[model samples]
Target chain A: MRRAFSRRRKPWFAIAVTVAFFGMLYLPIVVVALFSLNSQKSLTVFKGFSLRWYRAFFADHDLIGSLGFSLRISAVAMIGSIVLGVALALGIVRSRGKLGSAAGLVLLIPLITPEIVTGVASAMLFKGVGLPLSSGTVMLAEVTFSISYVTVILRSRVAALNPEVEEAAMDLGCSRFQAVRLVTLPALLPAILASAILIFAMVFDDFVLAYFTTGVTPQPLPVRIYSAIRFGVQPTINAVGTLMLIGSIALIGLALLVPRLFGRRESLSQLL
Target chain B: MSETSAVRLDGITKSFGSSVAVDDVTLDIRPGEFFAMLGPSGCGKTTSLRMIAGFADPDSGSVLLGGEDVTYLPPNKRNVNTVFQSYAVFEHLSVADNVAFGLKRRGVPRDERRERVGRMLDLVQLTGMANRRPRTLSGGQRQRVALARALVNRPKVLLLDEPLAALDLKLRRQMQVELKQIQREVGVTFVFVTHDQDEALTMSDRLAVMNGGRVAQVGTPEDVYERPADAFVAGFIGTSNVMTGTYADGRLTLPGGVSLPVPSRLGLAAGSRVGAAVRPEKIWLSDFEDGMVQIRGTLRETVYSGATTTYLVEIAPGVQLSVLEQNIDRSRREERWTGGEIIDLAWKPEHCLLLCETA
Candidate 1:
């Protein structure tokens, strides 16, 4: 009885580890968020509350331009990756041959390769192709890296869909393409929207790939923050970090809720 | 009344790689008729239905719908609908939207679509469930939604691939009657494919019995049930006591030296192999009359199934016959015939069916 009770709650040792783990995880982020609202510009000391850091962060033209560029890149990457990923998933599911299964496994390589390695490799590929690094390069790199995530999330969903639904569409009066457009797409709407939200959130705050692929005139928010922090941390950077963190949380919540709104049996987090 | 063929299959054959799914099938379904394709699993009944729906193409011959050959046409081009075995109602759409799907695809106007969808909902007895999601509906209601959705367009024929197979027993029985009534009211030809013999016998205006990708027989329910064409048809349609015997001069000689007289001149020579098939309920006991052949047998077992008692009586050393008796006058537990009791059985000569194909 005592062991069962201990199992339900945790041993004192485990409880201490849980507290310490979470404390270590959230302490730095909490400090940044707390300092973002401080009147004084001290990392260790929390002064009286003020929104001056947020005001400065909004007033900085270069940082604001970088933020806007990041949003555009993330949005384009989200849309581009979703289109290519959904097409690849459908092909993998329908292609019944040896080459298909091999390609399916090979596609998962991007998910396992280190993010730094992928960033460097993508930069070298652009250099080899004689293409100038810019926001387009960052967007392209983000889309290529995120396709695996989208395909991984949507493969099972495509399989779970009933094939008869499409047939019913065609029997009703839809051409083959129209059947896919009307029936198949609507059935997959919730999953597609959830994946889109997730992909957008991932690409928005992504740092390593953006650092390697972006041009010098303007940078994505994360790359800009990293460069700014190397010189000296500013309270405005904290303000920007807090805003990005909030956006990511909101996007994650939207991803988890979209499927539920459609009354689907799956949650997108489960796919992740 | 004038009659016309609604759907016709001429020498249709389909093969999947090396396996023949449907072989040399030729059949005609009449307009406004409830035609059922009854067969066991893997017997090409569903394949035949798919061919008609244009989801599958026959390797040879042609499919004619209302005298128009639609052999190579896709399902979208054909004016037909199918109710799949799984019901396959769209979970993403509401009941009304699911019914309006086909009509909407045909570029139907909004108000007309609403009116037709409403009338269809009323027909399927789901008038108040227009806004409900298909996932919330019960199994029976989902089936009704599938029916309503497919039937809203009023296609030339509604091909049902065991649509009631997903329902429970009581719901299946109730839906069988309702489906026949709907087929009559709509006056649309229904090509229903099912494996249940009782369902086929009850609801179909005419049914085709298929076996191993081939049509065994095509006739009215009574025609097939009362006069089966071959051994497969006789056993498939319903239960029959099929036994091998040698026929000589209008008499079948049994193993126990018992001779049963049959109707004369079935065009077979003497000493030919034949099967004497009889329904269990056709054999009579206790009440004896002229023009009936009576036999003596020892009862081996009696199955009391509430409404009727089946007595398995062995007339010879190895020849056994089952006799079904209603528990009408003898409903008490003690009044039923017991095993090991000597019984006298009588059946008319016409009641004893003689098939040239022995089992």
Candidate 2:
């Protein structure tokens, strides 16, 4: 009886390690959340809870402009990358022999290369091309860097689709393009919507690429937040962080819910 | 009735890399006839169907539909639809929407399309499930959806690539009867492809037996079964007890040094090698009729299936003949013979078939 009980004992060490890992990861965010509601200006102490910093965040025109700019950039980047990434994924999956394999390998380069390298390279390319550094440049750079991620998420999905389904469409009196537009696109809707939401959230919170490519006037939100932190620590920054965190969590929930809306009971993880 | 051929393949040949998937072959399918292309896997039956459906282009020859050449046309331009082996139902579309897909592509009016789709759903017996998704349906229900989706288009011909190959045995048997009835009602020439010989024999009006990328025979089910063209056709269509022997004057000498009288063929020379095939059910064990060829042998084994019983008789040292008898009026199971008993086997002379080629 004792041996059986010992064999079935709870793993205290593993439980403690898991709890400590989660605590270490979330303690700083918890602190930011705690101080964002603190009503005082001090970072080390929490006073009575209030919404003053959130109100201050709404009142600052510079930060609001940056927020709007980041949102527009994310929207544009998400659309651009999804279109190009889906096309690239289709090409890579359908093209036969060496060219398809080579393109598949080349698509992985952006995903594996360090983000700092990609940021520096994009900044240099824009400057070399004599293009002005602005929100447009940031949007273009983010689209370029994010295409590989979208393809990674969507390529497996496209490949798993039955080729006969497309053939069936053509057999039913649809032209090649109509077959792709009506049948193939609808079949890939869940994955496409999932990847779109993911890319939107990723591009919104991205910092390094936005920093290297933004113009001087209304920079992206992450870049604007970095500048504010350098100047002085403000509780409103914690409020902005909390808002972005909530937005990301919302995007993830939307991703998990999109497939169910399409009558597929797939989770967000399976969509990718 | 139209006098034109429904589909005609003129010496079409296709190759993938170094292997020839389909050799030079020509066939003619009559109007409104249920034609089957029967062969084992990789015997070019599906490839030929693809060529006819315009999914594949023949390397050397042309494909003609209703006496018009459509050799280089794309599948969209051809007046034919295929029910894929996988069924390939659109998971996102409702049953009615799936049936209305081709009609909508052709700019069919909304009211007419809805009426036609409704009628088609009724024909496939999925009348009330119009608004349901394909993922909610069972395997047999999905198969009906695929059939309705293709038949609703009213194509000149319909191609089915083993559509019932995924179903269980019970469902497959039921669908076979329903498919035949639906073909009669629709009156469209169905170019069905399947490897199961039983399916080909029972469903098709005429079938083409293919072997090694070539058409070995094309005939009605009765003609093919009664008079097989070669050893391969004989063995493929059903189980035939094929025995090879040397032929002499009105007799064949087996390898075991026994001689059996065989009908003489004018084309076979003396002392030529030949193969003889007899179906298991043709050989009788007792109560033989007059003028029947009788051979004595020792019963080596008895196999009792539910409907019929088979007895293996060793005629010579190594030669064995199988005799099948229906177990219908006789319920006394203990009265049947066991092994090591001498039994006289008799079969009509015409029931034995002589073949010049081996599979």
Model 1 lDDT per residue over A27-67, tens place = 98998899999999998788799999999999999999999
Task: Record all residue pairs in model 1 with backbone atoms less than 3 Å apart, i.e. clashing.
Answer: none
Model 1 lDDT tens row, B45-148: 99999999999999998999998999999999998999988888888789999999999988999999999999999999998999999889999999999999
What TM-score against the true chain A does chain A of each candidate get? 0.95, 0.96
Residue-level lDDT tens digits of model 2 in A86-129: 99898889898899889888989998898899899999999999
| Listed models, DockQ each | 0.73, 0.86
* Best model number under lDDT: 2
Off by over 4 Å in 2: A1-10, B330-334
lDDT of 1 at B11: 93
Please state the Cα-based DockQ of model 2 relative to the true two-chain complex.
Answer: 0.86
Best by DockQ: 2
